[model samples]
Target: MDPQNYPSMDQYNYSNNGGNNNNSGYRNQAPQQHQQQQPQQGGGYPPQYNQGYQPQQQQQQYNPNQQYSPEQQGIGMQQRGGSGNEFLISSISSNPLAQVGFSYGQSLFNDGKQYVDSNIGKYFSFSSLKSYFNVNTSYVFNKIKLIIFPFPQKTWKRRIYRVGDVDSYLPPRDDINAPDLYIPLMAFVTYYLLYGFQLGMGREFSPDKLGTAISKGIVGWLIEIGIFRLGSFFSNSYSIPIYDMIAYSGYKYVLMVITIISSILTGGYISFFVKIYLVACLGVFILKTLRVVMVSDNSANSHHDMHQQHEGSAMRNYFVFGVAMLQCVILFFFN
Candidate 1:
């Protein structure tokens, strides 16, 4: 309390406080002076220099190299976003129906892209459909490159497989004109005979009526599908004929029918599909002749223009169905 009276106020605690205050002033001044002298290294902005222009630290760019889990693979070929053909391991699509349809399209049946090559079996297969210059498989492969035409054939093994890559992947074949004449003939015969027997046994065997209905159904279906353009949308992805799409739809029905009806019978679905298959085969042989005869018949009457795509499809279908009907007629008489 009597500090002023002490022998040396300068040596007391009061003096020590004064010296400590001076030391702090010196320590703070050094940092400010050093900062003013040193120039910030990086270009453009400076680090925390002017508040208006706070030098921003350069942000490190995003590293794609960072490991990603399976879930982080981003959008892949398997995910059905834009197109339905993608495949994902365990993802439910926003559009469930599209997802299912796309899945079915991509995986099984190779998305309807396989087995359309007319030349795989030399004379019997697709070779007869068109006249090739060389008939050599090598030349055919080059011309039929998947880029120009996308077909749905398989790898060397012919076993079903996935094709995620594009460089090597070929688009599905548009025309599958391969014909198996012998088997088709037999199949055509069996189907009609069987159909005739079934109707006859049912006590409602009217050849004329049944023939008309079946012919109309098949012809109508083909005519409708044959005329479809698929526009530019489907054109980029596939070269499939509208006829096949329509025919396949009907054919799928036929195949299903074959599978179901034939199942109970001896051959299962094979017999039914085989009949149309035979018809397809027979069409191979009879196409030229049918065209000449049928065209001439049309020309004689001049019923309608033959150049119309729909008319052509109808004509083709008519021929195809007539052959099927002929087989059925034989069954009506005999079976």
Candidate 2:
């Protein structure tokens, strides 16, 4: 026989049997673990080949929707710290000293009952009252802003006065030099004349009726507008360091109460219109006066700084008060 016929030693095609592994019982093990199963230092059935057993590169975990950067997180923190409720920068200076003083003063006034304390230092007690007066007076002042006559803030100037200031949220003046002096004067004149005529004619007025009546028409309109102006002027923009602002504001409120009382006496409280407002006026005046007397010039300065913040708030108040005083005089003589 030839050598070709005798060479049958390589008849099997051993290629891991193409690794068609239907049995995971052995394939589930790691390749390294499978090597441990070999016969000790001798021969064994050849180890099974597993191409899928290589170590997989470890994957990093991530949530697609939760991604964020360090810069964005820092910005979020800063925004929470910069909110404005704790910092009303427009009302007072940013200086730490000023801020401290304002806060102290605000706290001092926030507690009103401390003023009657006899055991405490009188200055502290006085400070308490001063705070009380400052706040209450500001409220009263707002209630009577319109009595500061003549140069009233032109609410509907486009339709009514035809005059506006430079920073006007309203229309400009029709004639700059005219001053619109007589509008207030004439309206007030009509008011007093009607009052006297009704009184002289012995026409008794019910307080409620008169109050209700005066609340109508151009006259009532003017009164409402005046009171409205007075109230708005007492806002955060108001600054009067020397106590002049509050003092002036209180005086105007008093005067306005007097005017409305006089008018309501003619028309509203029905039967006792005069008596009601008369009592109200005297009561408010005396109470305010007592508070004023209790406070020193220093205490009065509590609201003084706001006057300087904007010259216009107090200036306008002063000018209008002058007109009211003039109208008051006019009403006094004729009525």
User: Using Cα atoms with residue i matched to residue i, what is each candidate's TM-score against the true structure?
Assistant: 0.24, 0.21
lDDT scores in order? 0.43, 0.41
Across residues 210-317, which tens digit of lDDT does each residue of candidate 1 receive? 686557545744453443323212222123333223322232232233433553475645665655453443333333323433443344345545555446546455
Q: What is the Cα-based TM-score of model 2?
A: 0.21
Candidate that scores best on lDDT: 1
Task: Write model 2 residue lDDT over 1-335, tens digit each, in one string.
Answer: 78877545444333234344534536666665767754332333233443334457888778788967898888976776666544656445868888899899998885654554644553233442333232233333433333333233343111233345432111112321111222333444455446545645566656655555455434533554455345435433222222322233233333433554456456555434443433344343323332322233224345767555345444444444443443333333322
Q: What residue runs in model 1 are displaced by over 4 Å at the alpha carbon?
A: 1-193, 227-238, 241-257, 263-335
Question: Where does model 2 exceed 4 Å of error?
Answer: 1-56, 69-252, 261-335
Tell me the alpha-carbon RMSD of every candidate: 24.6, 22.9
Candidate 1, number of clashes: 19
